[model samples]
Target: MMKMMRVAVFVFLFLGVAAGAARAGWDPKDDEKAQQAVDYIKKNAPALDRFFVHAYGFAVFPDIYKGGLFLLGGAHGQGYVYELNTLVGESTVTQVNVGPQLGGQSFSEIIFFKSKADLDNFKKGNFELTAQATAILIKSGMATNTDYSNGVAVFALPKAGLMADLTVGGQKFSYRSR
Candidate 1:
């Protein structure tokens, strides 16, 4: 019963934070953070530098806050969208998850689009990363033998915290031009 109550309280806190984040508009700080995140990723996962050079575009989320307790979980983040290395817009990601999961974590995520069509699709505000879209965790000295799925490749670098999950979720995104 105590554990269940703690989970309930966590869910409420998560919802409050998510709601507050949804109302946040574009801020220059996001740009700064995004760039820092990109630099960090490049330093840690040098292999991903090739994608920055060749990919048509990408979205970089500097901090994605995710929390899960028992069977309910959610994540939210704000990011910048780029095309050919140029910042074109701002985007937000909200995810809902359900399954066996616990703990909270924060991470940086980048989604690379392989072609114009894929980038356009994301810009049109119709992009959602389904369960089929898996993100490779970028860790130093780790081999990455991954490829784009449906013209997009996702990578994540954990910033802090620990979480264990077997949950299924989809990330929904919204975009606005700068």
Candidate 2:
């Protein structure tokens, strides 16, 4: 009985510590940052305004930090999800790639769902961007020729740093309702 009690206590403490560590990386002002990111996209890539208007929903990540060394690289970011412009939840994205790559960078990203079913799939936790998925880098006149490849259109604006990579990876997302 004592051994079982000790093991249970250890598991509880470990889970608590893990949760705290996860929350530690989040900023109280990230909501504000997400808003800023939306505004930045509006200003920098006015052509994307159409997606904002027509998308069934979207996820905005204010800043994604990414790095690569030799054959392995990964990226992570936290963001907010909106439905018809209404804030509904929070989301996180993590990506891993393997290729001959080097360098690092930070950027803001937004993914726009073309239909309710697409957004619903995202919320249901069944959405993933495969290695073939591509994001349109936001810039003046850049998005004018782009459209949703699948049901969602992804756009990214560089924030800082520089990375040159030829990698094949997938992005996995998790969502939590607010």
Q: Rate the local accuracy (lDDT) of all candidates.
A: 0.84, 0.80
Tens digits of lDDT, candidate 1, 64-146: 89988887788888888899898888788888887888999999889999999999999888899878786888887677878
| Error of model 2, residue 133, in angstroms | 0.8
- lDDT tens per residue, model 2, 52-151: 9889999998888887766667787878998999877788887777676689899888999998899999999998887778677876657476788778
Highest TM-score: give the candidate number. 1
Write out the backbone clash pairs for model 1.
none
TM-score of 1: 0.86
lDDT of 2 at 125: 93
TM-score of each: 0.86, 0.82
Question: Which 10-residue window in model 1 sums to the lowest lDDT?
Answer: 16-25
Which model scores highest in lDDT?
Answer: 1
Model 1 residue 42 CA deviation (Å) reads: 1.3
